[model samples]
Target: MDHSIRLQIEEREAASLAPYATLSRETKGRFRPEEECPIRGAFQRDRDRIIHCKSFRRLKHKTQVFLAPTGDHYRTRLTHVLEVSQIARTISVALRLNGHLTEAIALGHDLGHTPFGHAGEAVLDELYPQGFRHYDQSLRVVNILEKKGEGLNLTVEVLDGIAKHSKGRREILPEDLSELPATMEGRVVRIADIIAYVNHDLDDAVRAGILSESQIPSHLQKLFGPTHSGRIGAMVHDLVVQTLKNGGEILAMTPNLLEGIAELRSFLYENVYETNRVHDDFIKAKKVLRELYEYFINKDDHWEKVIDYDETTPREQMVCDFIAGMTDRYALDLYTNIFLPKPWSVM
Candidate 1:
């Protein structure tokens, strides 16, 4: 069989996709260019690379919300990324944008997230001199940590989308366009990230018995809908309608939908994320990471155990990298090994 499938797909993209879509053929290309695959376009290739990388696989054991949740149904980082990819692709397809690029961005967006979710992030941000943000760490994962530091070598478009997907406690569609990802596909992932997390987090909170459905603000329930799927559907529909109405030049949501989402986020911050029960665990998780950070930095023997440690890299940065890459179970087990007394056994 002829192996010119990539070329054929590129031709189809140009013939069918929107004017503003980020086509695979038009990628800014990887930092270190290699021979193109015969069967995959650049963005599709990027998506595959991200999916197969070690860092992406670690996402399954990482926290999304509820710290080390015992419940089978709570969202892990992997599930959250999948949800974001699904929603982003739906929007991209509606807008006639490149779904592959959108899925690539979504899949790679949270590759750098820490164990115990944002709690671990807060601890790293305070301890590290330069401060830590998961988005930057995620970029570092692809650029320097994965594949024995050879890196994923993904396209610039994917990297840009991954780097800029984060919007911490800010408006979904900010007044500053510069803060957003460069491509329309990237913007789709950005919105989809928040949409996925907000609804899923709320659902998890209710499932965990932390918040009753009645506790959710009546106005938001009315504005979006009463159920999780209802809320997500409303937001996704609004986003597609507004973006299409604006001719796909910019990704957008209706003013009311944006306001509702912002309010819902604030409610979660106060009631779910920052409440006493959650905050207590967050504090304990911070201590675990902080002690691990100190132990690894001060003890060369401990540092040597790190799989990717390099003598040339700063000890502090190496510690941060190791800690950030850890899964929730790994972090907890390591903590127990380092700090907790083992059973007295003499064989």
Candidate 2:
């Protein structure tokens, strides 16, 4: 009887993966110990857990670039993560790294982003006395809030990837090892995330008519090419070629292409992200989240009706977690029910 399918995979990894690859059998282990699965490796289990989690399902309704976009094709937070998974896996396989770990990180990376995109995050940041960041909140979600507070019990490697994957307009790959993911797989997700967003956001901007294909800076258009797939292909090709050239000891990219990608990101911020057409709705989104935060934090009697609470946890923290977990339409619908006037007919 083949009782240990997992052992075969682990053995294959040792035989096939790059020397730098993080092996599933060598995981740092989960927060809580679990019985070894008969069939799957650690990272494989992690990927399955994230895909089935409630927060992962909520991503479909969460904002990406556009808040409550009326169009069907606009990228939602769900779509963004899927794209990142594809790009990261592609790079991981090319480098002979741990593709399972890469997929797990990519899928779970944005699980804690607030509804209504950054506008909602901004509201929570201001409203929470300790302040908020989606990356930190993501860790909090997996550790304390998921599975009705049992938490996900994910591997420490996956947890580290989720925590450190955020770039936030900073260096895409920081020089400080402290600022980078503990594994090369995590770093791949970081770069893939930016590549997914910068390219897709630009595509959405054009699709939304916020700008035209011609309005983009000519140098960027030439470098990335005119099509969406072409641009992502160009970016991924450069990264793979350069990283392999560096002996896989470090993830590397040519300075010229790196700077070119950076310029393309800057161009989007100037031409699409900040323009009145896009910025105006986010301003309104902030207001919705702000009102919701205030209503929950200040009105304790009413809050008890909605949030299941224990006296030990701070109310503000509970409220912040509750808000950040919401999907875009769910936030709006809740706000309307709580704050908007309902038509009344006297009987």
Residue pairs with backbone atoms closer than 3 Å in model 2 (clashes): none
TM-score of each: 0.97, 0.97
- Where does candidate 1 stray beyond 4 Å? 1-3, 302-310
Give the TM-score (vs. native) of candidate 2.
0.97
lDDT of 2 by residue, 130-225 (tens): 999999988987887888778889999999999998988888767787888999999999999999999999999999998899998888879879
- How good is model 1 by TM-score? 0.97
Q: Model 2, which residues run further than 4 Å from truth?
A: 1-3, 302-309
Instruction: Looking at model 2, report the run of 10 residues with the lowest lDDT sum.
Output: 300-309
lDDT of 1 at 148: 85
Across 227-270, the per-residue lDDT of candidate 1 in tens digits comes to: 99999999999999988898889877878889899999999999
